[model samples]
Target: MSSNGSVVPRVTTRTLQKMRDNDDPITMLTAYDYPMARLLDQAGVDVLLVGDSMGMVVQGHDTTLPVTMDQMIYHAEMVGRATDRAMVVVDLPFPEGQIGIERSIEAGVRVLKDTRCHAVKLEGGAEQADRIAAMVTAGIPVMAHVGLRPQNIHVDGGYRLQRDTDRLVADARAAEQAGAFAVLIECVPSSVAAAITDAVKVPTIGIGAGSAVSGQVLVTHDILGLTTGYTPKFTRNFAEIGKAIGQAAADYVAQVKSGGFPSKSESFS
Candidate 1:
């Protein structure tokens, strides 16, 4: 039984494969810390991706390129420690796979060893196939990210929708051929997203891409309405948690100022 007093078996790569084969949808959410990871795991999220987007979302960087391996390992460790059943997939930060294949494998292996995460996500498709294959050979499961790679934000002149269907399809096929257990398709049209899903044998996890993929993932902050500005087109705010939290804080401050927070019944006996 888990801490929530329920029994849910640990999710593995093989389990995800079976779910894909059975036509069940996989769910993933980005988690960067222990509290969020624990809560999401208790809620039964299928995968907790320790995304490099933490560079922008958590650390206030302009791009994911600034995130380092040490930062990723630190955050991933907390997420891995908090998870009970959900598979943890940590992002291999910039300059890791973009370098030589050996260094890339080393980086991936370090993430798995240091954080105890189940898999590592790399941001590329065809050019990353060698790194993906090498990592798999070295016992690190790789999840390939195709279309709208945030790590490539500099080259693309900022985040834009990727709709090159032929390139996207080739990348997905290369990643599947390279032994990636899953592919994350991001910021593409529904038609292109669906085409990649059909082309790839492995599970296709969509972000800004559409619903036809085998699974879906989004930044947890976006879904919870924690982000303040510039909402992505594909994400829906399921709850206004940011507003609720602000209101709760305001109420507490008002209560404390009025000395109502320490009422007779609230004091120690």
Candidate 2:
């Protein structure tokens, strides 16, 4: 039973596979709350990702690893309630939930059942391929993330672009073999991203991984021009809504101070 008194219809795994087979581009946006999810759905977004990136976007954390499964479930459930269209894919945050295949499966199933999401996403490639395989075998759909894995920030010393084209290619293949429906390529070279997309059977969604991949995913704040901090160079600002909002607020203040607001035209009879 869904919280909204409506049937929770799942975005089927077969629909995702069909998108891959048809070469249709997959569109995903990171949405943390119900209103954002509802707006994204109205805008015709194909996927609503309840990304653990929420730690940074919503909780003011420096990394995503600190987000717990309970938090993830709560956020996912929130987005699920507001989403009537578009598939919701929730993230499996670092360290806390992804201990092993069993742990991942247990966590993933809980997220799907509790939040009514279509799938779950995790960071890693070949090193986590076995876990991906296990999830698939357990009937859970998985989206594998490679390249700039935020969960590895502590070990990698920070967010750095991955080189090693050969290793990258191998990792992508491993992900495909592990039955990932799609793989997210982040902060890798365009040539490498293109090669990986071609080498794998599933689709590749790129984020600063260059244009050669099959699809694109961007953080909603960065794309909408609402984020407070510095955005990546690859981020293209479509509408500086943050500045617009500030200007609008300033105008309202001035209007009220000058008795320009609630004019005769706006005054109630």
Best by lDDT: 1
Top-TM-score candidate index: 1
The TM-score of candidate 1 is 0.96
The C-alpha TM-scores of every prediction are: 0.96, 0.87
In model 1, the clashing pairs are none
Instruction: Mark the 10 consecutive residues where model 2 has the least summed lDDT.
Output: 1-10
Clashing pairs in 2: none
- Runs in model 1 deviating more than 4 A are 3-7
Q: RMSD for each model, in Å, please?
A: 1.5, 3.9
lDDT of each residue in 203-264, candidate 2, tens digit only: 88899988888778999988889887878887888889899999999999999999999899
Alpha carbon lDDT of residue 189, candidate 2?
A: 89
Give the whole-model CA lDDT for all candidates, comma-separated.
0.92, 0.85
Give the per-residue Cα lDDT of candidate 1 at 246: 100
The regions of model 2 sitting more than 4 angstroms off are 1-11, 251-269
User: What TM-score quantifies how close candidate 2 is to the native fold?
Assistant: 0.87
